[model samples]
Target: MTKAPVTPLLDRVHTPDDLRKLPKSELRQLADELRTEMIDAVGSTGGHLGSGLGVVELTVAIHYIFNTPDDRLIWDVGHQAYPHKILTGRRDRIRTLRQGGGLSGFTKRAESEYDPFGAAHSSTSISAGLGFAVANKLAGTPGKAIAVIGDGAMSAGMAYEAMNNAEQAGNRLIVILNDNDMSIAPPVGGLSSYLARLVSSGRFLGLRDLAKKFAKRLPAPLQVAARKTDEYARGMAMGGTLFEELGFYYVGPIDGHDLDQLIPVLENVRDAAEGPCLIHVITQKGKGYGPAEEAADKYHGVQKFDVITGEQKKSAGGPPSYTNVFAKSLLSEAEQDNTICAITAAMPTGTGLDKFAAAFPERHFDVGIAEQHAVTFAAGLAAQGMRPFCAIYSTFLQRAFDQVVHDVAIQNLPVRFAIDRAGLVGADGATHAGSFDVTYLATLPNMVVMAAADEAELVHMVHTAAKYDSGPIAFRYPRGNGTGVELPETPQQLEIGKGRMVRGDEKQGRKVAILSLGTRLAESLKAADQLEAKGLSTSVADMRFAKPLDSALIRKLMATHEVIITVEEGSIGGLGAHVLTLASDEGLIDAGLKIRTLRLPDLFQDQDTPDKQYDEAGLNAPQIVDTVLSALRHNSAGVEEARA
Candidate 1:
């Protein structure tokens, strides 16, 4: 259990090419150093740790055996690709992971040739790898597409879809099922390793093919029996019947931590020419770290931590997160109604519904990595007169858009969509950013979209969504702690198309109006304060609902104010677009009233602090002030002169 003070072997290798040059005997030492390096780097940077730790040896084995950059290795979800990143010429930048202007937390094609396909979402690697493999085959090229996908990702239907069509790629496609969590086939030991190596070996494969030829020449009924016998024997030993049925040549249940098993089995698969192969490798999450191994989720996602004690940096006590507020509020609602239930697409803790699950196990459904199914399942529940809350991240909900449209919105099913992480998420970057939910969901018919300005607002929204039974209702909240506002003693039901005013109305010279949505209310208020000081009367309205457009409030603002602006923490076609449409529809723009919309820039923003991201998106207080000043046709100094 002693850690190395230096990564001597790892220091000499900058890329997988360098790694491939090392002797097979030295690989174990190299793997040990790689593990230490990943641990040290993640401990400093604070990102996905446990999954990366589990894959250290498996990563080393893949890079060592395959001719990568040409071989095309894709990691499913890519949170587990840190060690892969370190081995593939990104070791020096490993410490900069998930930071602004630094390496991405997931696999990105722009970052390195080693990452052939960019992936942050689960169950995509196999599909992407199949494309690469089929491309190489069609081009008559010299490469294989290797997909290292975890078992958690395999619960999704896409992996099997890719496998069913993998026969076209011949031996060019290889799937390494990284069995780290929710193991599909949990048998891994000496026997498993032996069988894995034996099945994948040249001699065993040669004999099987020879037996197949003999069996094909037999009588039709006997040939069927022979094929069944051969398949069942391997299936009984390796537990690969499912994959084999999907047209994959299956190997393993091999110990992933053992370099000896991984390297040889990978080598056998590499040399084989008959396969669209799958190698099942079992590994432990948080493999090399003691504290991580001892904890649940295995320190899956973490803040910066001490390498020695494995203690993460504690947060200075602050307000409860919006997620927590939502969980508690939903739990309270559930207590009142027996028919109310909750569902998450394998994101119990992230959505803060783990506590809800604990409280009402019978009503909670964790629909393992299948967002498509989760939405439809909730619709089914709602159709039967149960109030079902389907809590999911905005980014993930994109996967179930069809179901949202067909099953919920079209049918007018009463399903509540508790959307968490509804804006630009900080460290997880553009892929995980929940930027499009408002834009996409708002456009759908029979859909009501609301965004919480703060924790208190989230509580009210949750209650409102629960009460709403006419159609699909979705409420969005951001990904951080609340604004520390006092919660209402009892949650209130907000009127569907109404908004509340926060600051000045028609009193002080009647000039500017700022319509705020989501968590940008604080910034809008600050902008109003700045505008007031600059001799411009400003009104701040929290337009809580993104859909239905608060027609009364918006029309009133347009009538009273000369200049109007809309601000929201979403992409181009969100609150701003809707407000502009409302103004256009009413022919209010023809009356010489100038209107501008402030929203997230029309681009995918990278990872950074929430404040920096907002600033970059031009949705901050300063930006809001700038938008108003420009609309009024006055510079800061000019505004002062006008006031004087």
Candidate 2:
């Protein structure tokens, strides 16, 4: 284990209040110590490193200048909040980030009073900050609402919408545009290019230039006095015309890493009594770390690493990840079909569309961090007779639910939705868990939803979506590796709304039938093995399609088996609810057959290993076996009572 870095100035600080007690001279030292401490902590725990490193100086300056907890400071996306966490009384638990029962990787309202608004999603901070500012004005609160948003987050429409309404908050809202020229990937879109131009314009005025400009407008005696005023300092540095047009007092293009420049500028902005201010602070994503600074992605997210060498720990070799499989399959499909195009909402690498982007540059569209636009854009493409694959993570797809329903599903566009990270994503916690996609998408009319049992199945589903032109079709797959299934050399286009029985014949006296959806087939097969050992014949069926569910297979299972259990790695209204509704409509359950549903519990599960999360949610192999046994016992009791 690596020893924690020596943080002399940081050791003296326990909270933001402790930071405020220190003089301006020690702030630079404190920032350095804070950076070292943060790097060390993240090195052990393995989390968002580059973002926190970029915001070290800015974090110190904000907490020191602003009266936090009273002054609501919200970090956009909260990936950069590690430094904020350390300063706001969480330094003791900093090493426990993203662990089972430790500090969350992102800012959580329940975790700290300093975190006024919790966030994991991007571009939400400005709107949340505006709400806070407006509420504080109504309540006559003393503090301001500061939103530190990234340049990448600016690509989303929500930020601009909030900026447009910022005037309502009066002088209480402060938006700090943390421009590092990157989000998760190198930022795309016009906003990115515009920000780059703004940074490179070289129009930033120094303090002397500010004084000279102010001195010209004042009398000789007042001229000297005017130079010392906060207004003069603000006027010198404040020149982002684009933001000014949006009703914000634009104040920056300042050095974010330089505490000397940041502290005074922020102090001036805090005291200015302006309506709404936007401080554009320039920074490098991986500011101090050598390895991160040199790397293309700047080590955005990393595993546990050597502090000295900056070498990350290697994963144990296994089957290719589901993401890689999807990428390969999509590329293969794209090779044959000229009409097939790909789209991602600022998540090229995360959704495995980066490879597709490389292969078909002209055909791929990275629409920044705009999921809603991506959905509608894909709809437009599909309407124009082009096959558009809008590959998005299931969690993020929630943001564009309205678009899916109104634009695509209602119009019956042939848009292919490749939803990655379809189930519990460990460490990111409930906010990022893809638990409700099945419920949301499956509920929509003209929408076909499928979940892959393994990587091979995912390939077939991709082909199926490409071939199907009736309406919007979506296939969901899990976050991690496949179940070691051999990939088919030539992918087959699966028949829509059909399921395959992986184990046991329907006529082989099967007492219990396990209807598995998504990647829970592995656990279902395990449960079937356990049931067979216990002298109870069990059949396992991989019900791939959630929407337009395999009604024929479901009927066969209902007719043959005395006990039928529906299992999926989703929430209540997903596979189980669909099955129950179908059976009830068909009058299948009216017979003396026992039925049970296994799914993620109603409440949101916290950060843990995928296996542990499934166990907690009662969707594991043992839980499946228990559900089957318990249902069988209930049926046996009913039969005996009737005989008596």
Candidate 3:
């Protein structure tokens, strides 16, 4: 058991109001204490460490400068809000972060009044902030809307779209660009600090205002020339000419870590009565922690770690993750087919495309935080006679639904969607759960959807997608390590729209049939064992494809079995829904044979262990047995009631 580090200043802060009471000079010490507390808390809980570390000072400065709850301060992608959580009346529960019934990893509206808008997805904060700002203006409320977004988030088109429309809110909207790359600002030292102080102060802006008025009075041509010259000069000094063109008053390229620089600038921005402003603040991802700074990812997300050594606790060695299986399998396919390529939206490593990138540098594309562009880009590649795999997380892929429908499905393109994280992603909560991908993609006219039952099946699916050149095809796999099944030496392309019976023959007096999609096959097999032990003959089948479901297999199961049940790890409109629709359409259930569908419940499940979540959804082995027994009992009772 690890003990928390001493945090004297942080201990004093129960909320942002407590933070606001402290003098401006004491803010740097508070920020240090806050960073320590954040590091210690995340070290125990194992969550997004680097992002929170990056924004420690900024989080402190904002709360100190602005009256939050009243003034809407939204954190984009919310992974960076751990420190913000610690300061905003959640410090006691900070250690329980990402655990069951504990605090969420992202900002949630239900969690706190301070978090006006919940966010786990990137590039949404600007638009949400604009909504708040416009609503406040209409209501005549004395509040401002501030959106703190990252540089990576700005790559998405939605961020720019929000920026283009930002003038509507005028002074009510504020956009703070947290540039971790330090691309927008000067190096962190004397010159950057000096420049930041001068610009944030009233005197510098007063002179600039005077110059602007004088320039407006000049001849039209001279004024235009002067404006261009001024824009160019500012662009050379501070990199925000593009933001200015999008109708925003561009400020800074300031040192985000320096409290003296940060506090004054935030104070200035808070007091300013002008149009929308974009303050470009440079920050380091892992500013304070030595181990985090030294790491390649800057420990963007971490597991439990030793505070002294910063050595993360290693997981018990097991089978390779589904992500690794896909990457290796895709690489194998690419070796044989040179035209095979991979693309991910700012998640090369997350999607295992980093392995592909390393192997095939020219063929791998990392379209930074742009899922919509990634989908269409793959379509373009497929259009030009190349096998393109758009590897994106199922949750993030929702951002490209329009492109998936319009550019890929409607056009009948051969772009392969390698959807990872395709089930309840534990700890990320409802926002990041890959629940709807099956329903969304299976409903498409020209789309083919498949789910892997295990790592070996994932390899086969990868090969299938590579060889497939018909229309849009997708294959989904979950987040964690695969079940310890032996991998095939070579990849094999599975027959599309087919399923295989894993247990029991049709003539074996099969009274109960369990049809499983995705990784729930193991549970189904276990349920079959339990049913067989109870003198109930049962059959289990693994249905690989959800879109082009094995109707023949369904018909065979329905004919042979007295009771049939469909199981999947996805939400309601997924495999179970498809199976039910098939049974109805084929008139298979007209004989009144008992049938049941087990799926994730209608509500968004909160963050918990994957096993616990599945258990809660009643998709486990015991639940499956209970469903079958319950269905049989109901049928018997109904028949008895009719006879009476």
List per-prediction Cα lDDT, in the order shown.
0.90, 0.87, 0.89
What tens-digit string does per-residue lDDT give for candidate 2 at 1-644? 77768888899999999999999999989998988998899899999989889999999999999988899999998988999999989999999999899999999999999988889999999999999999999999788999999948989999999999999999899999998873332323344334333422324334435656868888877886664453444433444555765788665566788786777777777776557878877788878999888873738989998889999998889999999999998899899999999999988998888999999999999999999999999999999999999999999999999999999999999999999998999988998999999999999999999999999999899999999999999999999899998999988988889999899876665788999999999999998898777767889999999999999888888888888999999988998999999988988885569889998898988998888999999998888988876776643235344224
Tell me the number of clashing residue pairs for each predicted model: 0, 0, 0
Q: Which ten residues in a row have the lowest lDDT in candidate 1?
A: 502-511
Task: Estimate the TM-score for candidate 3.
Answer: 0.96
In candidate 2, the residue pairs with backbone N, CA or C atoms under 3 Å apart (3 or more residues apart, or in different chains) clash, namely none
| Stretches of model 2 off by over 4 angstroms after superposition | 182-239, 296-298, 634-644
Sorted by lDDT, highest first, which candidate order results? 1, 3, 2
| Highest-lDDT candidate | 1
| lDDT by residue (tens digit), candidate 3, 532-557 | 77767899989999989988888888
lDDT of 1 by residue, 1-644 (tens): 33535988999999988998999999999988988888888888899998988998999999999999899999998999999999888888999999999999999999998988999999999899899999998899999999999948988877888889989889999999988864677656688789899989999999999989988899999999998887899999889998888889899898889988888899999999676999988888999899888874849999998899898988778999999999999999999999999999989999999999999999999998999999999999999999999999999999999999999999999999999999888999999999999999999998999999999999999999999998999999999899999999899999997889888763434789989999999999999999888888889999999997788788888888888899998888999899888888887775568899998888999999989999999999999999888877788979866456
Model 3 regions more than 4 Å off: 183-189, 214-219, 296-298, 507-509, 634-644
- Model 2 CA RMSD to the hidden true structure, in angstroms: 6.1
TM-scores for all predictions: 0.98, 0.91, 0.96
